[model samples]
Target: MTEATVGEFTTRASSINRALDQIGDKWCLLIIQEVLWGINSFNEMMAAMGVSRGVLSNRLKWLQEVGCLRREEGVAGSHRPRYHLTSKSIALYDCAMMAITWERDWYQTPALDRVELVHLPCAKPFVAQLRCACCDALVCLRDVSYQPGPGATRDVREKKVRRRSSIAITEVRSEHALYRNLINVVGDRWTSNLIALSFHGLTRFEQFHQELPVATNILSDRLKLLVEEGVLEQVVYQQRPLRYEYHLTEKGQGLFPWFLTLLQWGDTWCDPQGRGKPMQVTHNPCGEQLQAQVHCSECHGVLKAHEVRFTLDGEDMNP
Candidate 1:
C-alpha cells in the first residue's frame, strides 16, 4: 500500500479514462516512440517525421506540457533544450507498443510499414485477447466493459466509482491470423485521413472521396472492410431507388471514448493538424461542454477504471 515508485504502476487505481486519453492518439504514440528511441532533440524528431517544422514543434510542446517530456538543458553542447520521458511516459510504452502492433497487422498495406511487433518478456505478438474484456465475445468497445485496471487513483471526491452487475459488451471475431488487427475502428489514420469528414456529416460516397483525395480503390476497400467487421453499417434511409449511408453501429460508436481519447492525445501531444482542432461536444439537456468521462451504471458516479468489477455469468459470455 505504499506509493508507487518510478518503475512500478499503482495498484489502487485512479483515472483509467485519463490514462487512455493520454497515449491513444496515432501521433502521440508515434512521437513518444521516436523520443524514447533516442530522438531527444528537436532536429532529430523533425528529421524522423519529415513533417512540417510547425507540426513537429507543436506535438513536442504538447507532450512536454502534459508532463510526458521534460525540457532540460544540454549536458555540455550549444545550450539547447532536450526532451526526456517522465516515469509516467515510460510506463505507457506497453500500450503504445500494442497500438503499433495493431496498426501493422490490420491497417498496413506496404511492406515498409508492415513491421512485426512483440511483447518484451514473451517476445511474441498478440498473446492476449483482441476482443473486449467486459463481454468475452469478439466485439469492440461500444457495448463492452472498460473498467479500470488495478493501478488506478481516480478523483473520488469529484467522481465516484460504482459497481457493475452485468456490464454490456459487444462480441466480434475474424478468422484472420498473423497480423495486426484494426484496433482503431473509429478514428485516426496517421497514414490516411478519416472521421473529420464523417464528423462534418459526410456520409455519402462522393463526399468522403472528395474530402480525402486518396485513391478511390483504397477508400472503397476500407469502407467495405469496415462494413464487413460491423464497425460501419450501410443503412438505406431512402427506399425509392435505394440510397445508402454509412452509419456507425454500437461497436463503432462505442469508440467515441476512443475518439475522445485520440482527440485529447492530439491536443496534448500533436499539433492541431487542421483536422486536429477543437471539437467541443455538450450534453443536450445540461449544456455542459463535456469531456469523455465514464460513470457507474448503478450510482451514476464518475468511474475510475478499476473500482468496479464484472462477473462472468452473462448471455454473451465467450468460452
Candidate 2:
C-alpha cells in the first residue's frame, strides 16, 4: 500500500497489515540505518546492506520516492547516483540508531566496539545526549518527565495514566522499552520529549507535571506502558505509607545514544530556533561543553552524512 494509505493504519481504524507498513519493511529500515551510519553512495549501500541487486534497487527507489532518501548526482565521476537522507529521514536517525543498537545487542556481531561521537570543543569522546535548554543540564533517559505537546493523541485507551513511582528517574534496571526495541515507542510527540526530559534527570512526578501540562490520562498510559516494557520500574520510596519512584533500568540507560541521535535530528531541522543551530551538548564526566560528530565504522574517522560511499562487496544489492 502507499505510505499515505499506510499511515491511516496507526490511527483509529488501522488494520494489522497497515501497521506493518507504517514501520516499513526490513529493506527500508536497513537502508535507513546505512545512511545514518554514513554509507551514502549506491555502491556503498549495496556493499553494506548485502541485499540482492533487485531488492536493493527497489528498496532504494521506494525510499527515495517516499521522501526518506534523496538521489543526488555525484560530483567526482559520471556514474550511478548517490542517496542522501532528506531532512525528513534524517529526523528518523533515532529510530535508525535504535534499530542498530538493538540489532547489535541481540544479533551476532564479530566486533562490538562502539563508534563514539566526540565533542569537538573539548576533544572528549562525547556521545549524543539531551540537555535542557532552560536549565542547561544533562538529561538521562531515566530522569526526565513527560507531558503531552500539541501533537498528543488519545489513540490508546483513555484513562488517567499514573506513574508507579514517585520519582520518574531511577538507577534500577528494567526491560520494557527495548522489548521490540523499535522506534515506534517514542514515535509520538510527547513520548520522545518526555523520555528526553527524564534523560536530563527531571524525574519527580510534580516536576513532570510542572515541566509539562499533558493530560493526566496520556501520561498515565505512557508511564504504564514504560513500566510494563521495563523502561521504568516502580521503586518503594517511602516506608510508612508506601511510595514508589520510577527509575531507568540499565536496559533503559543504554538507550541514551539512540535518544540523543533523535534529539539531534529534531533539534537540527524541527526546531524553530535557527534550525536549532548553536546546539551545545556537555560532557557528562568533565562538565565541559561538547557537540556530537559522526564517523564511519570501517574507516574509524569522522564521516559526512552524505560523503561516505558503499560498494556491494561483489554481491547483488537491489531490493
Judging by TM-score against the true structure, name the best candidate. Answer: 2
lDDT of 2 at 144: 43
- Cα displacement (angstroms), candidate 2, residue 241, comes to 3.1
Cα TM-score of candidate 2: 0.47
Model 1 C-alpha lDDT versus the unseen true structure: 0.44
- Quality of model 2 by C-alpha lDDT: 0.48
- Candidate 1 matches the true fold with a TM-score of 0.43
Residue 280 in model 2: lDDT:
47
Off by over 4 Å in 2: 1-95, 106-180, 273-279, 284-287, 296-299, 303-319
lDDT of 1 at 280: 41
**How accurate locally is residue 291 in candidate 1, as Cα lDDT from 0 to 100?**
38
Estimate every model's Cα lDDT from 0 to 1: 0.44, 0.48
**What does candidate 1's lDDT look like per residue over 10-107, in tens digits?**
22222322343344333455566566555777776666644447656766786877788888887886677888888657645334333433444345
